[model samples]
Target: MTGFHFTVLIQLLYRVGKAPTVILQPNRTVVYRGERVTLRCEIWGGGGTEWTYEWKTNNGNAEKSSNEYIINRVSDTNSGKYSCMARGDHQLTEWSDAVTLTVRLSKPTVILEPSGPVVYRGEKVTLRCEIWGGGGTEWTYEWKTNNGNAEKSSNEYRINRVSDTNSGEYSCMARGDHQLTEWSDAVTLTVRLSKPTVILEPSGPVVYSGEKVTLRCEIWEGGRRTQWTYEWKRNNGNAEKRSREYRIITVNEYHSGKYSCMARGDHQLTEWSDAVTLTVRLPITPTVIKQPSWAQIYRGERVTLRCEIQDDGGTQWTYEWRPNNINSPTSSEFMITADSRGYYSCRGRRDSFTITKWGVITLTVFNSHPAASLSVSPDRVQHLIDQSVTMNCGGNDTKWRMRRFTGSTSPSYVQCSNWGTMHGSSCTINRLEDHSGVYWCESGSGEFSNAVNITVQDDYYDVIILVSPVHPVTEGDPVTLSCRDKEQNLLSNVIFYHNNKLINNDSRGELKISAVSKSDEGFYKCQHSGKESPRSWMSVRGEKD
Candidate 1:
């Protein structure tokens, strides 16, 4: 038996032996990252003398007795074509087929900083590509651009004084020993100048005492937005007392001074705008106020609200609630009144809706909630069996409770799992029975009502009405008119009914009734519903209750 080399291994795998020839079969290929790969080399001969097996990673002289060579954490570095040799000391030899392994890296990523997009031209822009982890050496960096300049570096590249020629497409490549990566996606850069400009204020200024206006700054030749602060003063006598520039809103008699502005640049202030003179004027000190400070009265209440406006920065101010809380020319106070519980407030109306404490004076006349009521369908003391009943509850938000008693000795509880249906402070529960006694609901804190009770009288097991169809049929159906759970708490599949007589008992679903027939209907449609009372409705010629 001979060892394996590229030539020797190829000859054995071609099967140049006799009948019952021995051949090595390899296991399937393709392995996942971090998983173990097992290469099996077994002979296909029917029978033969005991033969030795050899394994190798590549065509290296290294050989092992085991026909299987294992690789742990099968990464791309561990990938290649592998072959095996099978021999029995000097008896015979055989080799196995070769299999290829492909290693793929999770997508690589590039990271850049100065985070928020806006990258300026001529400014330094850095890009770094990072691969998860693959201890490598001897790397290459490549940069491409529409500007047609060669950009290559062992690691990184920097350009100074970037010009119009430096604008447009950009990309990079990372190459390492035995590994090659493609060029990254191209990024475009548009070069723009960084110069400063100006923004105009109002035309001739008769600047008001305390009025606020804006002076805008512009970049006559740049892509970057400029930030600026404004200053104002008179040009009369003291204009030379100012430094580079000054900013202000108000204009008093002293504000009769000259005014100009200065703009900040990347390095320093560019220059100042030509000085402009200003005149001064007095604007009205507008003020008005609202009373009861509101409108509209709530039920069971009389409503009153008022408003007042005055114009005198100084005066022993005394106010009168408006003309019937409506129109009042003279700045004075106003009045409002509410007969019942309502919302109203009063503020210093000397200034229109502005300077006033009207929100604080808001008062509520009365506080009352709805009634704490109680009622049970089928009467609170009636006996019923095999029937479906619904309980409707109303009045202010409330807590609910239901206790049960077999006779009058031991007490149990009636419970509901989950269902939130409270509208207009009303709740409706359906299907009440003997065990559903002492059912009550009450409002939460400050509800102004006591616990309200809902009664259900489904205690005794007796004759329940029998009808062909039930009241309030839900949607479409040839529904079976039948009974549910037995008196013993066991439920019954429904049975269908025609006219007032028993028909077929099958499925129970939506029930649809065609055109009415005098003989096709009857009073009292009943179906057994054990704990869930059977639903029954009487079909009368003309009557709905």
Candidate 2:
């Protein structure tokens, strides 16, 4: 059986092979230019033989068969039955189903997504087209406008400029591939008008330091004026407001924000063009800065510091104390019941909002003193040695410390060793000559008690003009001076005036001068008017220095 099988295989392999060839197909079809079409044939299995193919058509006269059948751009003459044949052993003929072609005709489709037929001219827009889905080769597109000649393309057609002339019933034709796809439905595109521009009045470059200014924007291409409002905001900050043409009555640092505008034709507002900003530069900088940045108060003792903004900031200004005890704290004048000593800070907001509040008064509440200790009053004073002194001790009070201030500076004087057992809210120094400074107290919690001042006979003066230029001016050079008391201080900056003219101002115990001469000499004084204290002065001097 194996031998017989091998013999059979050998005989099968010895069979002769014939050349593979191609033949025209039956059921032929025709195509038009710019139309998506397919060319099909009646395929006969030529068994394992690759064949070359050619199609020929008989002229419309039906007498002569020309070998020029087309797959695309098919003319009417290329529409007859195309016959295909193979020629090995003899000529075998295969006739295609008849096809009708139209080369001069084309159908194009229009695909578009209008960004509002009412388009703003000079802005960009697009028109799109695709072969309705499955794309093919030999396809060309034809397009015609109401005013221009027809256009042709393989894929897409575009109208860059659109107007009433360009605005007509738009249509397109797709032609060429082997099979023709039906033409697409037509679409109409209409052109619309654009929005008008706006302008600012009063012309910029006008100086407006304080007051509400009005800015108006006019629209020329007036239609139905919908929401004809304006927009105003700062480059920074949470303050933003809107209205038709902005109206700002009071202007300051906050008012020096940014400004921009857009005209809203009802619900739809045009995009803002370029931005315009108003800058309100401050006339002064704060002089004093505090540590812990806030303060806690007891009842009435008195606390204050002197800080000055800029000298040219003018005298028509007032001062305030900022507690910072509240979140988003604001600057204010005196508000605490008494002198306080705690974490605090301050800044100057325009007083136009309202009067400012402050925090620096002292109030010594006579709470229940510890049974194991006693309490005292009159925290500070001057005295000689052997003077009868009173001291109070309280068992309830555990932590303890004493304070002293001189030359407007505060430093620790006494502290508890075993505070848990120590007592006394008040203690007097026994006739001390070595002490002449401001005083305050502290406990274990690290919170300083209300401040007080104790003085002993002393003849020492330390003065530095922190706010003034070091050198004296000859003629008209700006010069300033600072006077120190080495006594009371200020939470606010201090201002200096010599010869009734403003020289320098600062929160530091100092003063300054911008333009000065020998004639500008006179007496100088500093006063912490923010919350406490009367005016304080420096020793009289001449410009000779």
Candidate 3:
């Protein structure tokens, strides 16, 4: 009995004693193809003993000196029930329970966060490699790109501060336990560095006050419109508006500044646009300039007036005149009638309905016809008979003729040619008895000029004559009258008379009135050396503002 028990104990020592347990990494039954798997054989109650492992698969069986059976790269043939056994020096363990392993041909899908194809510079981009049907499996990723890059071993690939050089087609493959999956579809990445452009309406570096202004932020990319949020800035300050267009209803001087804009969309922010300058200016003041350059206007006369504005170069302006009753034209030059006498004002209007200050002017008009002026060469009203005298008709007409009314002539009206030598608008005649009458000028339309009385003296006696102006003098003008003898010599101790009344008895032989007004208009005469001169009229015109 002792020998038989020894034999049984010796056989049990070399035969199976405890069953081995198959331990699988990841503890999963389903796995992807090309995945790495390891089966470890564990023996209970077998301590401190070296053992060889025997692995059984659906395809075949293999023996390894190590207690663990490892598949470097699992394939479809590796998908089957796996069992492991351990062999010791003096004892052996039975085969552990079968562990099923499924090596599937499932491909992984690469997902891109913030999935837009284009990304701006200085942006953070993340690419993820996902394995399908790979639960409970730790995966490592291998990334590929058109642009050369260092290999990475992570499920997620992150690009920080990405730039234009980092743009290319990117693909990734997942590796779990030393097995690699198929590369996913390429997730194209386009890094853009293009900036936006700012545009201003009316394109003015200088704009008038109270004018409308508009600013636009534009982005050009393949001529397609993109939905983006805009940011506008003035003078490089904070954002003013978020819309693509910024408008100002009535721009003033306070609105003048440099402007810029930028855009952000699809998790990307573009660079700020080049700054555009804007300037606002005050409205110009217009000035009214008269063409005739006269303070007084006469009837039957046409005057041209111009509206002038400073700093209006390269600008189109329309004129507006106040006192619109005159029916003024819209041009800068206005033709004014004599009847349109009053205060005139003008303003300039721009194309955008901006206006300038009003410019004012005053016009004075005379209704009645003014007598033509007559000038004599001798500057005196008295002359001796048979003495040569010249007279000229001064006026705005060319049809003026020198005429005289002599009481002794056959007809009362006669031209200077009938009794003297006639020139163009002038006549030279030898003084005779018939010439000692009222001399004047007459136009072809029967309008008469001021008449002057001439006394024909028989000899060079103690005779006196008055020298006065023949034409009407404007108000605020100077007038002078002097007395002369028959020989054309000035005399002293003169007594001046106005309207047959003694006004002055001065010894200067002349009367000087500074700033003559309408009150100074009357018939004036002077007496010198006990000789009284003929009365002459001094006409004065008034100025109105």
Candidate 4:
């Protein structure tokens, strides 16, 4: 390897380096008027070489012994593309890439937070001074209004409580490091007084309990209608509400007090309204009492209903009735007659504005006599000939006799000895064909009880009878009837008739009447395969209370 003893020398050289890059002090290409800007030429891998920079701009080129070029106060004439080159070690580096600079000379703008400068007195108002292209600059704001000029160190001018004196044409300007910007366009502010008035709906000092009332807060002058929030106070206590009006669906004695209202907007509360006094009077409720107190009355019977108001100290009052009969007396008592089988209500009025709650009652009346009831020992639709049966008469009255009708010109009333054995209220009889008739109990005063039909049938005729209700049925009640043979077995494939006319042919052999009314009362009968039953009478009572 030492043969020849000769060495070779190689020279390595690193060119000056890649092109340098131009950088801004704040790293932003945009600058504002009177703003300080510094441009730097950065070289990488220079090996700690000291370099001098040449800055090129649209205006001209300048050479500096340092790498940084600074503009103390930039103006519109300083806006352009700028680049720099570095010279070190007797070699020149490539020109750095260009950076664009924008300088704005226009005046700043005045911006309000709520946009609209119209506000109410005692409200918070904020005014902001905005510089469109003046980023990265610390500015001092000057607020100029009709009042005077104010030098606020911050960009925002705030008034914690703006008064009427603060309303006027407002303009703003900004001062940065170098010079002061021109005044912006004027923005008008209007401050108004917001004093509310409490208005009662009825406009009356006294209102009856259980009446509807409303209290409205009417603002004298304020901002936009949508900007206001309402608060109601009763006797210095807070009432929760948001709308302008506070309503009470049912005002009672507890609601009676001094009420006032205030409005809030723009972080300010208006003055409380004048208090309005309200007095809620308890209304008198009258009760209706019926004289000769009874649940029911005869058609021609007389009765009296009196409207009595409790705690009334001999106050002269008039009465009002639901029927409002033209010929009715204005007194508290109302005389009921034959046509008085319905609901009755009454109310008392001491004056046009004072009235009591209505009191209501019901009266039931019947057309026929409802004295007693007659029943049989073994209840059945029809009884076999020569079968023993007992009949009983019972009611509030005891003096009664069994009466029967058998197509006779004159009806006969008798005791058990003539037809059956009598004991207390019951009579036992051995049924005969002649005993088949409509039987009932008759009082000594000629009042009769509900009647029943005692049918006696012989087995020889293969007879059938209509099974119907024995007692009178009230209106709006369901009634059903069926057909049966002599053996007491229900029959099918039967056709029913009302008042001797065909009503319907039921598959279930039943005549069903739903919500039976007075029009349904009449004689009802049924017919099976070939035999027809005897027609039975059905009664329907009128509606009652």
Candidate 5:
């Protein structure tokens, strides 16, 4: 049996063509839940033959043998890849390329018609309910609110006028034939009070002339997203100002008025704010300040004038002085050296701009004879250290005494017995020192002479240069160099040097360097009449970039 068991074998073969293709009836793979869909399988380019179709799904569901598949209600659980094949009598063709099907749940949403979530009171608003993936099915709508129990059946909810009680969260839901959609995401709705208030900038409504004033309109309860246009009325005037604030610069009496403001936003107008009144008055009058004395005074008597604002108290103030109806170069106070006589007036100022009314005062001058004149023996105002100097009071008076006014001390006449010898209306100092100052003559009748200033220089009276700002001068700053003796007496026809090299010769004994730089910094000195001064170091600091 094993040897002779060679049986005849016949091989069955089938000609194969292009693979089949699957087509969806609706041409769309995605469908909403509870929607009906049909998928049809087709075979192309195969020989004419009777065949049976088989279907497979990537979701591991059982296979079927139909050319078309119908789903009464598609759901998320039935979504997957689908394929089909055709089996003939002699052979089976390859499966078609996969087609994906996706199912999504329907969800409803609520949207505001005007887009802004915040609405002013007395404004009309609308809320719309919408459902996606419902497949043109008729749906019933319902709304829920967090603030109060509100029910509505239509797809849209209309609010004729919003109020504070309507401010809360809002949500919607839709119901179809087969299912009820989940509640949509909540949307917030705000209803705000649109009452506005008016305020004064300086708090106090009363202000002086030349002061600035501002009126501001404010809405306290409205949301920041609300845009507003302001309307302001002043003192019930017919004209209305369209601005948030009204400013008055250099305020005067005409600018004082009662102001009221109102706002309009979100298609609604707010109530007028409380009215506020402002008043502007003239500045306080200025007063003259000085020692009380007779309005009329004789010549050679010192005169001083000072001005003050009545309300200034101790506050600092600047003064503008007018002498004889002409502007004078004086501030806060004025000094008249016995030679001046005129009518003086002054105005007190705050911040150099706000000025008060001017205060006036008068002065008179009278000339007298037998006046004394002071003179120094050396003829020069400055004397060398330890050098004897003689002072004589030249006048017609027979009896006279010398008087001195030092540093900041008050003047008083006294005898020369303390520090010098008195000889025939003259005083002689054996050795001059720093104590020497302004000197004059006083007769027995208390008549005073013209004053003369004497400055005693130190032993090191050589030429020296003085710098306005000592060392470490900043770049771009002005610098001044002065040539003088040890007693600060300026010298003329002096030559200045930088780093031992001659720079320039100045007849005024002063050198000015505007906007100093690094090159201007070095050892500096001055030479006058073949005399050289001690060298001084100067440094310029550069600014940081």
Candidate 6:
């Protein structure tokens, strides 16, 4: 081969083994503020071989000679076009394609004071717009809420006495001269309402024993009814109930106290309501006192009936007295000249409406007969076992003896000895027995006093008749009759008798009268399987005349 042929072969071999092309590392052109950005020089076709690199900007400025061009902190000053070249052992490659580096302006942000995004009613809050880079006082702030433009212009927005209508998403932007920045990150603001009020049912705070009471708590907020949880506190203690309404089956004196409530929903708790008070009172029972505690008083003598209260405090009392077939008198103590015979009852009053139970007494005024007359205390014809009975022979005479008669035997009078004790003109019988009979007084001169019939019964074995609302029931009122056995257990399938005549045969052994009249007043008894209960008298008083 000649020299020309050899040179052509060498040129063809050098063209096949040429240097690789240089290129930029990253394809992106945008960079943010305060970010670390790196531009690298890369060779595309040089099969795993290393090369030296050099970088330059479009402004003709020389950068570093390393394989990578780095900007520790990029800003607006770093914006330009960049290119790189790679150097191999044989020759240097051409410049890479130019890459535009864009450094954008920083975005502004919105911040809320007092930490939380929620504020209660009647409270103040502040929202501040912040931009990192310094742009002097010429920067104007604009705000938007819930995607709608707001009419404020200050950097700091102050809200006074915020309400529920002020809740929305808020954002801000900065404008200086002819340049306006993009909107900042959005923040949410929530305005809440205060707590609700609690109310009592029946519209009154006073409660009596054996009565039911109810308390209700109401909340008006934006949520489903089932989402709310109610908490109730009695006298400032821990929660006792977790329902909207609190109920009391029965109220007593110990149940008197204050009450409050609150509501919790949506991971938030509302303030407590204003406290309310409850007052519970006990049943009132008054005492009746009869002056000159004697079995009988002569005509033209002075007698007094007094009404009193027991174990009571912090109360002022008035009184009322009712005598049979006569107008009632209002006084604590009533005085009368013993010229009439009647049944009398008295009651005490705390206020014009609040009254105690009535207590009954019987008074008998006797005329002066030439012979002595015998009378009994309590004036009741029937007496219970284990009860005391007293008999008095009217007169100051000392030589008086007591006698008891059984059946209709002639002259069959037995002198009192083992049956009772005698104390000058009076005889006392304790622990009455079934054999006790009619009694009369006998003077030393063989003259006899008036006779009185006395009947004795066993209190434990006798049936009890229960009257709803107790005895002395007012006329034109509903009444219920219940028969109980000696053990206080209710008797079923019993027959009720009024005035010794069968009136009703009920399975539940109860008799009810829808409205009572004067004719309903009578003696009542109950009978079960050939056993009869002692008669109990029911008294119904008419309305005031």
TM-score against truth, every candidate? 0.25, 0.28, 0.35, 0.31, 0.35, 0.34
Count: clashes, candidate 2: 103
Superposed by TM-score, candidate 2 places the C-alpha of residue 113 at a distance from the truth, in angstroms, of: 4.4
The Cα local distance difference test for each model comes to: 0.41, 0.41, 0.74, 0.74, 0.70, 0.68
Query: Per-residue CA lDDT of candidate 2, range 1-545, in tens?
Result: 56554334332222123322222333323344444434433344544443334454453333222233334433444444434433222234344444444343434456665545454433344555555333445666666555357577645545554443445555555556555545456566665434433333324422234544555544433233355655544463443456656666665665654555555544555555445555444334455532212244333333344334444343344555544333221322332223223544444544343222232322233222212322233222332222333434334445555544445333324442311122356555554445444344555565554343333334333322222221112445554444333342322465555534564444454444555543443334444443212222222122232
* Each model's Cα RMSD: 26.8, 18.6, 33.2, 24.9, 21.9, 26.8
Off by over 4 Å in 4: 1-369, 377-383, 443-447
Predicted structure 1, TM vs. truth: 0.25
Expressed as tens digits, the lDDT of each residue in 1-545 for candidate 3 is 56554344334456676688888875888777667787787888778877777877774665554777788877777788878787777676777888888877567677877688887666788988777656667776788887456377687889877776778888877777766677778888898856777888766566778788888998755333557889898998888657999898999999999999988877767789999999888977788987445444554344567899997388778888877743466889775444545888899877554678899988876675556767887665556565788889889888899887655764456788888888889989876655776677778977665555565655556767788764556779887788877667777888899877888544566788889886676678887667777676565655641
Q: TM-score rank, highest first?
A: 3, 5, 6, 4, 2, 1
lDDT of 5 at 186: 86
* 310-388: candidate 6 lDDT, tens digit per residue: 7336566677777633324476777554555777788776543355677778887666542676778745445556678
Clashes of 6: 0
Each prediction's number of clashing residue pairs: 55, 103, 0, 1, 0, 0
Q: By lDDT, is 2 or 3 better?
A: 3
Q: Is candidate 2 or candidate 6 better by TM-score?
A: 6
Q: What lDDT is reached at residue 364 by model 1?
A: 46
How accurate locally is residue 170 in candidate 2, as Cα lDDT from 0 to 100? 53
True-vs-predicted CA distance for residue 372, candidate 6, Å: 85
Judging by lDDT, tell me the better candidate of 1 and 5. 5
Q: Which lDDT tens digits does candidate 5 get at residues 450-476?
A: 555555555554534343333245678
Model 5 scores worst on lDDT over the 10 consecutive residues at 291-300
